[model samples]
Target: ANTVQVQVILDRSVPDRTALDIYSRPESGGDWTHHATAVLVSDGAEPGGARPSWPPRDADALDVDDVYEALTAAGLHYGPAFRGLRAAWRRGNELFAEVALPEDRHDEAGRFGIHPALLDAAVHLPAWAGLAEVPEGRNRLPFAWSGVRLHASGATHLRVHVVLGEAGSLSLQATDPSGTPVVSIDTLSARLVSSEQLKPAGRGVGDALFRVDWQPLELGPVNRESWAVLGDHGLAEALRGTGVSVSHYPDLTTLTGAVQAGEPTPDLIVLPITTHTGTEAGSGSQQAAQDPG
Candidate 1:
């Protein structure tokens, strides 16, 4: 494409919080593809917080070589830069790992809170963590991440703590050598995928990934008698300009409270939302992620 638009929109509701995503069409006439999504927030706690001592005294040491080999056999091949899982130990369902980027990459760590290679390595430790009880050969793929916070930037070596949660979720807390938190993930959810589903595409036309075609919707004129807009009022102003009278409210809770307090009820309520694509909706937990670098 000759030109593409990349937008960065900030959340005015929350200070120092933002969400970023990109969508670009392959050609000028093709539909846009969602490249990626990531959020940055300041709600996370700072480093030097309370945590267990470096490596727990009672946990048995795991052979790093065997661990890497097992990962390869499972089809997760780690390159040298990503081979950061130096030592790991498991005490019950929890896992502790020591991860670091190669020495050459250490100097580049100052720009971010744990390099992506090292962070990816730290999260993979949970696979060998004896986490779930399922049949053999089941593939687990991470889909969504929630409550991710990067506490500090520039840490090559990190001590990580991972706790398995619920049925298919886990949490990660990585700290610097002195125990200052670098990055924390409240929940990293993964779903069990079948081996047949994990197989490479292009085996035949029947196994190919589906292409998306967007259709224009025919929107009818407004049919509401009275309306109320919740949260942001920018949309409400637009509707007003179009001759649609909309009562603005800070949020739904307050709007309902007013109705309960004898205020006139609205015939319609409006808010902004973004829905996932058809592929994203249909794939659900079955989406196959690319191989680990």
Candidate 2:
């Protein structure tokens, strides 16, 4: 195999952040050959006729490992199986790069599940075209999606292409190793926002209780206090306004009997938050916190 060389080019914008090209060649010539490219990204305008500091002039000798380390430090762990960026450079109005996706991403269905979360992270590859720079400290933020599609379930290799669009949006397309279309993602966008800005869109509460844990409770016990709290919380009012049915359990024994008879339990179970004794205490509480069908 022959050695393959990988090069990274950061555009004129933030010229100093550019990294040197990398090379990888096989010791045996009989195996398949692979090649890749990358680009750097930055926040400022391009420098005119400026040369990159090269040849290890002083204490700082920029190397491929240094750039890769910077990306990893910035929470850029896309997974170790995928190959790193090869050659990177910026175009007139956008940034571009060529990356090699590993052959192991396919699933048994002959298609990649390609979860929305994983696709979103791949969009950041093009950002490296500007230059390698330390990212500002920030917590993980949620990303929004208008639409996404996974064209193929399983693909051994991939070619990733990205473009930054208007309104701080990004577009990405992944192709097979032979340059054939594997997946096309459109109307995609992402942003870095505070955690407080993210919230669940719906609200509901429920719990499940098992028979073993319920066996010790006294029968015919009523939780009037819990009932009052539910009433004050507007749960009863909310139920009354809707067609949903609400049931009251007099004691844990009744709940366990229902379970033994294979009857569906109520969605919500009212239990006092007071402490309990024995192993049932911890186990019962855990069961209560679980989702009930």
lDDT of 1 by residue, 1-293 (tens): 13555544445465786767756542333445565687776663554447787687677776766766665555555678888888888777688899889999888887765688878888777765432364565646677889887878888988988888876689888888888778888899887765556654333443233576699999999665777887768999988888877889887778878888888788777755534557554533322222111
Strongest candidate by lDDT: 1
In order, the Cα lDDT scores of the candidates are 0.72, 0.43
What's the C-alpha lDDT at position 284 in model 2?
Answer: 37
| Deviation (Å) of 17 in candidate 2 | 46
Score residue 18 of candidate 2 by CA lDDT: 41
lDDT comparing candidate 1 with the true structure: 0.72
Candidate 2's displacement at residue 93, Å, is 3.5
Can you list the residue pairs that collide in candidate 1? 48-180
Give lDDT tens digits, candidate 2, residues 1-293. 22434434334555545432333333432222233333333334321222222221222211233444544444444454443444333444344344444434334225445533334435545443322222343223224444345556555444555566754465666655555555555555445533233332112421222233344756796543222112123555565456545544445665566556886655555444544578563533422433233
The Cα error of candidate 1 at residue 84, in Å, is: 0.9
Task: Give candidate 2 misplaced runs (Cα > 4 Å).
Answer: 1-67, 82-84, 103-121, 127-135, 138-142, 193-293
The clash numbers for all candidates, in the given order, read: 1, 29
